[model samples]
Target: MAELLAPASCPLCLGGDNRFYHQDKVRCYWHCAHCALVFADPGSHLAADAELAIYRQHENNPQDSRYRAFLNKLAAPLSQRLGTTGLTGLDFGCGPGPTLSLMLQEAGQQMAVFDPYFANEPEVLQQQYDFICCTEAIEHFYQPAKEWALWLTLLKAGGWLGLMTKLAPTQDEFARWHYKNDPTHVCFFSRETFLFLAERDGFTVEFIGNDVILLHKKALS
Candidate 1:
């Protein structure tokens, strides 16, 4: 049993004493009482090359109408939240094709992008922005707390951090969840987890839909 080394900390909240939740032949999933984030054991994470290879197989493209329509789930709502045009934004984890940046640009915002594997624009990350959107990427985080901290720094005061991911299923449904079948996915977030984050980290969060989350950073006092 992998839980033999079970006294694991919640990667997102740094909460201690996470207990065993479930296990498949592949990996062990642990439940965090403090933040409600269910995550896989770090020992189960794939190597960098293996993860990158999987992502490279994706065919997402900026010109694909279906892909653009899909991204509108996050883009349209974020544009509405920004409530105006000409704002600067960053597409924090844009995968290879980079469609969201174009979508937001059409909505009248200037957009930049940074991805550790695909875009890798570290200089862009150094600049603050009015908003940042990370779609379907948070699930792959190995060090979620560090990633969250970096996003906070990249966002200007009162800025929005939009995200899209398949929120974790109820405990009963987790075993059969297709989302968990993706080997690259490590961190699983439930609505309660985001709520805990908003209260602890000083952000106001809104659940846009099943998967879209809009979190606003508190302006400095």
Candidate 2:
């Protein structure tokens, strides 16, 4: 008989230990004690082609009023912090239609967008920005640590990194949580996970809403 393997390490914080959190017919989830992030085992994540197919089916119309309102939740607050015209920002992982970038542009922020499947603009990632918005994208990260480090590098000093994703629920609630059902969503973050990241990286973190978070990079002295 083969011996059982150990639980996977936490991807976000590189914590070597984790506990089984939840499992459905399709995927198993784990909880990181060190960072409080609940995540799906990467083996269960969808292939790139399958993931792109699902993303292509999204009705991310920029003109959709309801969708615009949903994006405004992050844009409004981020713009308030930006405070002045001509600030440059990047909408990291802006999906097919990219309504959030449009909303920020109308508010006098100059914006660029990068989506691996849709926009696929490599040059955008090459430049630093005053702020970066990543709405509904962090959960899909297969390697949260690398992706986050790149985002932090692409941000100028005193820059803002805004994120919007549904936070994970209590451990007891995980078995039935709908967010875990998405095969593309490999990593999940809670408020505690964000706080852990902020403390680890020296960024000032703020929870703007139930689904929104902002991490501010301190300016160089």
* Per-prediction TM-score to the true structure, in the order listed: 0.96, 0.95
Which residue pairs collide in model 1, if any? Answer: none
lDDT of candidates 1 onward, in order: 0.91, 0.87
Quick one: best lDDT, which candidate? 1
Cα distance off (Å), candidate 1, residue 24? 0.9
Each prediction's RMSD over C-alphas, in Å, is 1.2, 1.8
Top candidate when judged by TM-score against the true structure: 1
lDDT of 2 by residue, 87-163 (tens): 89999889889889999888888999998889998988898999999999999988888888898789999999999
Clashes of 1: 0
User: Could you tell me how far off, in angstroms, the CA of residue 149 lies in candidate 1 after the best superposition?
Assistant: 0.4
What is the lDDT, from 0 to 100, of the residue 45 in candidate 2? 78
